[model samples]
Target chain A: MNVTDLCGLAPPEPLERILVWLDAAEPDEVATFRLPHVPYPLFDHLTLRPCCWDTTEQADGTALVRIVRQ
Target chain B: MINPEFSLPLAVPLRFFRTAPLWLLLAGVLFLLEPSTVLSSRHAPEALALTHALMLGFAGNIMLGALLQVAAVVAGVRAARAGLAGLMVWLGLQLGVALLVAGLWFMQPLLLQGAALSLSLTLLPLAGWLFVRLCRSPACDPTSTGLAFSVLALVTTVLLGSALVLVLTRGAALPFAALLRQHVLWGSAGWAGMLLTSVAVTVVPMFLVTPPWPAKLVRLLVPGTFLLLLAMLCWPVLMPLLVLPAAALVLPLWRLLQQSKRCVDPARWLWAWGGLNLLLVFGLSPWQAEDGILDAVVLGGQFLLGGLLPIFTAMLGKIIPFLLWLDYRRQRPLAGPLRHMGQLFPERWLKYLGWLALVAGLCWPWGGVAATAAGGVLLVYALLLLGMLRQACCKAVAALVV
Candidate 1:
């Protein structure tokens, strides 16, 4: 749910970049990111167990992310 | 503690998802078996029948079914009396669509009346229920906003469609072309496209590991597209340009997909095929600038590849496996190797299906023998998908029962 937890998962560089973006995503709009390979459990966690966000997939394997920070 | 509340039974959504391919196959058969009737004229009764199978039967069914999930998950709302509502809405939709297709194909007044009556009995209340839930949901993000508008467009699409049906019944020789254009504009662009855009903002990123649609585009794109479509009502020239922007969205996403690291995924390729089809719809605009059979072919390909089928293919890869996994996890109670979405239906098969879809898409508008060939390929694609899902269901059931 937090960046430190994501750091603990040690996602590859591509995914880490998405996490970094998610940290700074603007409100009420989508921020799409892509991964080279199917990511680890941490990416799945962010998708299914979003703390204050929603995750979607594009036609390709790119990730379209939106966060709702309280 | 992001424990999302499960709303409708997976059965409700799965039933609709599962039925989708069958209807499309029926569409293919209708298209193939009556190619002369269907390919010869855009206004042919047989042609309309083929379209209905795709529109009301295939696209509408999937969208409505997926709507329950989107409403529950994204909008923080649920269908009222989920079980009964699901059944009533599904039944009404299937029957109404069937009658309308029949009425149009045969030009039967009674069937048209029955179609209108069936939809009146079912679509209005169901749409209203969904509309209320979506409008009232606390989620105020772009996806939810787009969804709320999409539902409104659905209401308009249905009413306009009903009016057309009524016109058919009255035995009046009115210039229904304008009304028909309006109806298609709202139905596909306003309702279907809007909802697709809404879902894309959510599902595309989560599943494909892709970037979200730019917030500004998500905000301005959907509503702006719908309004422009509305403007096209008085100005028919707007027709060619309507879906161009929505389709243009693919190029940037295609660039992003080039950056995706998902090495073994077929979704990226399928999506690319879809985007290419959208581009082609406009790119080949000069061949049949006006509304001719060639133009119909281009539009048909856009809806099939760019619009509905590609997304359906991508979502099936996500949803069916997820549903089965959820059941396996919840119902098994014993320790076993749970299947990932990839394991249940491997990426290779998706790749194969993707190829078939591409071939079928190309063949779809060629007419005559080529159109039949497209149907053959599409039939295989649909059967493969449905068969895989059916196998997964059986496995899930076996696990649950034991």
Candidate 2:
């Protein structure tokens, strides 16, 4: 799994970058993103896309969101 | 289908943000009418009108709008019938504030009575609803805790304010001085102060790209500030201690701005102005006006215009554009190309507005020609702000149609 660290980038940048990455990924390819926190609003957008994702709280207070293109 | 549980409709928050500038415009008009009366004394009817125009009208609208959106994000739960509830709250506030301002300006007891009743009905229910929602939410983060406390503060402030109205208009024999002090304390430190600090925890890091607030500060700031407010209520001499929280909130922003990658962002300048205002407000104590240096009116202006308005204006600049971008992005399939937030609103406009607001706030304490000019400048600021939001909304709509 490829891991992307998006910890310090502000707002829509994090949401936008991850969506762009997801769009270009191969089907069934899984990627994990380390975010500053749980991307609540991004969940709204992901609901519309053909993707499956799960978020886990990391020990360091960041959120690790793993996404796989469906 | 988008989950209604997780999604907030665009119209809900937009209605509030768009209406905020109108209140500022009203404040400008009141100032223009009689700057001397406004600057004369804090207890003067004209001064009270101007204060309410900013507080209940401008700041109230913005804070409530922000609460609707932030509550959902931090709590991970959307309020039931949020749209309808928001609309009702907006309408009630608009009506209540108009009556309150008119009552103060005209000195009509009947209008004051109506204002008291309308505000109590609207704010109590609204606070109660949000408090219940925050309490039920599983996410117990600092931001959520702050939101809950701010709601309680709003309740205390409103009750005190209503009591004041009765004393003034209904001839109720209450301890007017003590009630007024408590009202100012909770309204400023409890309601407005707490909300700003709590919201900053989320907004500063997410929008400004600052490192998260210190973990210890995040946990203690809200609860600790509330305790101090309670302490001040019991012992008014501890009122000066409230400055500690103000300093704590401002110091981190200055520190972060020094390290922020988006150093030139206009919002950063406004934050600096907000910090400066906090210093001036605390340094020039209202009680120290006995030597004829300044009065409570100037202190009030420092707090509202310099301290609160800048922060609110800067946040609106970022939030309005971002919200428009979000809405446009959600419909980009039909809208064709999505415009970024910067494209929706120009940063230069915000920069200009910030400078103008600073000028207005600085001139507010002086009563004569300077204040008159400040009134004119504030009117322009309000119009420019309103124009920016309207244009952004139009751009989003036009793109969707195209």
Best by the DockQ measure: 2
Candidate achieving the largest TM-score:
2
lDDT measured at residue B355 in model 2 versus the true structure, 0 to 100: 93
Q: After superposing candidate 1, which stretches have Cα over 4 Å from the reference?
A: A1-70, B1-6, B172-174, B282-293, B305-307, B332-336, B399-402
Show the lowest summed lDDT stretch of 10 residues, model 1 chain B. Answer: B330-339
Identify the CAPRI category of the predicted complex in candidate 1: incorrect
What is the Å distance of residue B126 in model 2 from its true position? 1.4
Predicted candidate 2 versus true structure: per-residue lDDT over B34-134, tens digit per residue? 88788777888998988999998999999988887788765665767878877888888899999999999999989988998999999999899889979
Candidate 2, superposed: residue stretches over 4 Å from native: A58-61, B1-4, B290-293, B333-336
lDDT of 2: 0.82
For residue B342, model 1's alpha carbon misses the true position, in angstroms, by 1.9
Q: Which interface RMSD does candidate 2 score?
A: 3.7
